[model samples]
Target chain A: MELRGKELNKSIATRKKEVLENTSILSEICQFLELKDVARMRSVSKIMNVIIKDSQFIWKPILQRTFPEVRILDHLTWQSLKNVYKSLRDYHYLTFEPHSSYTVGIIGSLGKLKPYPDIHSPEIESSGIFGGYSNYLLGKHIISISVLSIPSIKSIRKLRAEIQCWILQVNGQAQGWENVLDEHVTNFKMNQIKSSQILIVINSDQEYKTDFILDLEKKFKIVILKYIDNKTFENLTKAILKICRNDGETERKVYEKQLIRTNIDENSVQETNDSNNCILS
Target chain B: MFYNFNKIEEVKIRLRSAEGHICEVEESAALMSSFIRSMIEGFNEVTEVSLPNINSVVIEKVIEYMRHYKDKDPPIIKKPIISSKMEENTSAWDAGFIDADWNMVVDLMTAADYLMMIPLRDLCCAKMACKFKGRSIDELRAEYHIENEFPSEMEENLEFQHPWRLE
Candidate 1:
């Protein structure tokens, strides 16, 4: 009885192997797996690796299922689909908090951000001048960085030409900083600033300086106040500071709306007024 | 000839499995399989269908699924399943229904494919996916009995090419 049972188990195992060896069946199985799982499956065997890497049949359905909003153009090859999957996985929204007293500069190459294992709300701080480089693994390129809550339009007007932004890419050899942001770019509205390059706001007038060096293998450093004069840095800092402030009115209105819904009595109205005073103050 | 609607409802379809065992099912339930439906519709007064690839065990399981879902549709399993657990990804009944051993699940999947039962095929696929989900490459190879064919250097190269696979 024991011998027969062993043989039966062996047959079943063989049958299972046969099923997976069939490419058509394997493809069906892969369709149900997540992108990461599918990517990992490529390492299981040579056949699986070829099946996954070579076939569009496996990727097309998985891509459509995972990201239905992403349009699959006719020209996209199998490799492109794989790249799209990886790119979407790596894409993130990065928030930077520059210190008030220090001149902050962000220097890094695009698309070299390291992947974090866990998904968390990331808030990168700008370290002070001569403050050792704080390396932030960011995405391929900056699509848009909107100031979360602008204080007021009046403050925005005060921010004009105060913030200087630059995009520095060091290819093979070291080069000087290129001032990428023009006057029009500096004169951005309350929430309409869009740039493909990095945005660095430095309070040039202050003695405290924060230099951001992107930790790349190639030694690339942001030469502080070397290319542009001090006036540009001061203007850049004012604009950035204005953009970063939290809108007090918006916060108070949200609080008022919540309080009014919960409390209908006259005492609640008085409490709402008190809360508004607290927020404004 | 004039046919009564009630008479058609009372009809039973005979499904002959590979083992030459005959199982009777209500015509309505049997119609869930598109292959069976086509067979019944294409041929005149045909009630018996032979399944050469599906054995008695798998056919019975398929019949169980067809009967249960005859009145109402099975719940759709979402793509890119959220959880490794089948229960979280699908209805409790479905999760339980597909709670058989891996070999049985694979057999049912093949049977469902042959019979053109898309929902059952999809359910079987999801059950199999739950096994593969969140598993490491070595774990997957062990689970499926797949041997790593690539040399160490090639494996390292592949890993370098796909950095996202690294944690």
Candidate 2:
């Protein structure tokens, strides 16, 4: 069945006339897509773009339906709302406009590590996640945790400051030097280390007298690090290894006595290092 | 088969256009053909008002559409509630209308949108989207005048080398 009719007009004037009537609807459609400011949206002919920004343009109700919350912003767990907003405004779309606002996901403060009030301590300052909007409230958007009760304003401000500092310094460098604290000290994966060896490096000046050192020496499993010459440290490691290899009971006992006196041991330290081989964290 | 009427009797009565054009027309016929009358009404409301950059051709089509459906139920024509069969029928018709050269299709769509022809404009753009689907990045760039700004090896290195992409 041929369902057709000869309604075609060959004149340019006719074609132009029909298209002229359709321009108003086209402008409304572009606004509905929420692409008025988008470069690609702007490229849909010059005339359409001009009427896109007008206040009289009432968009359809569906356009008002909220867009899916961006999970990408949540991945920036360490960024301040300000920094996140800036990155998003520069790289991605955030309902972005000069007068618009963006909201980042909520972030809890480090002080949120505190337990319940009945179990509180003075050293654990009362800090919390604040639903704060910073700058023109445009750059980085964050949805802050809702406060159930009135909290101390000063404490929350302190938390906000710390959170901002953390966001600014999130460059993959650990918070402090590894040698100063020891490996795995500040790491979250403490379970990865099956055992721990307390290695104490003591200064050798005459004023280095403390009950702490005497108390440490009472253990036959510690390694006391002193300001010894390089050669002496090598000799000490060799002697400790030799003691572990000995078969005689008397020889082992003698080595054990030396470990207690000088605070050095080899067998236990080697075993501690071996446990970390099979774990990922 | 014709009834003779005196010229003086015909001259006794007068007809006027909606725009105040003195002419001859059958009032009964004009009332029955409500589409033409409404088109004239639309013209009176819209003309003498300047749309700075709008082309004349688009306006003509809008008028043609207004003339076609003016006497029909306005709200029903504007927003049709369709059954499954009706939707399928409309889809088939829309597909044919939109199947045209890309530039012509875009022009029609842009025109339809500007004048608030919702159904026609939406179907055409959706057809365009289907045509664009599965196209290669290079093809898309060529068609849309988009630039491949990412340097060579960028696709491979961007994920692994960036510290943020790591856990």
**Candidate 1 docking class:** acceptable
Residue A52 in model 2: lDDT = 32
Worst 10 residues of 2 chain A by lDDT: A163-172
In candidate 1, what are the lDDT values of residues A1-281, reduced to their tens digit?
99999998888788777766677777787788888888887778787777777766777678768654343322335455555655566653222223322212223322122222221112222111111111111234211211211122233333323322322222212332222222323434233433322233221222212132232111211212222222232222332333333234454346434434433332222222333211100
Candidate 1 regions with alpha-carbon error over 4 angstroms? A73-78, A92-281, B1-9
Residue A220, candidate 1: C-alpha displacement in angstroms: 44
List model 2 lDDT by residue over A109-143, tens digit each. Answer: 21222122221223223443233222222224322
